[model samples]
Target: MLPPFTEETARLKVQLAEDAWNSKDPARVALAYAEDSEWRNRDVFLDGRDEIVGFLTGKWERELGYRLLKELWAYTGDRIAVRFEYEYHDTEGQWFRAYGNENWEFDERGLMRRRYAGINELPITADERRVAV
Candidate 1:
């Protein structure tokens, strides 16, 4: 059940999430979620792996040069919370830094069953970007 995660395990899980997202591969990232996983990303509501893949595909397409960092906020039982910041540029090369918090729930096999994220984006100059892809 990968439940009751220790500090080390929780941190590892957070890093895994960060790495998966940074890969910008829809199929690879979808592997981390259950077949019927549910997600609320920004204003979009999605259910199932297919939807998740589609959502991420469109997201990465528009958010070019994406780089992400995620930190473990808290964990209990089969659930975890994380705070993350990501830097990306739009099609026109307008840079932005996005800050968000995600609450995740895992199934018995340690595949995520649910994810909820609230995000805010701030405009940033190219010279202000601190994250490197």
Candidate 2:
């Protein structure tokens, strides 16, 4: 589970992350990252777990009803690539489906040390919802 991952463990890691994020608890989700983790989520940059926590708190607050699904695209050594999608609605009741890809680098302890993500969002009607938390 640490690194140089087997296929089973890599998929497990992705599932675990999806579960944690779907919980929408910033502090809880931040535990999966290294203390000094670095992240480039979309356009914002974050350093350390504190920033991670802060960023997620804001994200969940704004992205109401956030539900996420993550799939392992590839894995080798300490690096893993993932594809993910999430659905959320804004305060104005506009629903959006977001698609993204992430590249993760983990430390020996299995904590994520670096995360890079590229995301795109499309507005959809409520009836178009395909995911639920």
Error of 1 at 64 (Å): 0.5
Off by over 4 Å in 1: none
Q: Report the number of backbone clashes for model 2.
A: 0
TM-scores for all candidates: the values are: 0.96, 0.98
For 1-133, candidate 1 gives per-residue lDDT tens digits of: 3767788888898998889999999999999999999999999999999999999999999999999999999999899999999999999999999999999999988999999999999999999999876
Highest lDDT model number: 2
Worst 10 residues of 2 by lDDT: 124-133
lDDT of 2 at 114: 99
lDDT of each: 0.93, 0.96
Q: What is candidate 2's local distance difference test score?
A: 0.96
Clashes of each: 0, 0
Candidate 2 C-alpha RMSD relative to the actual structure: 0.7
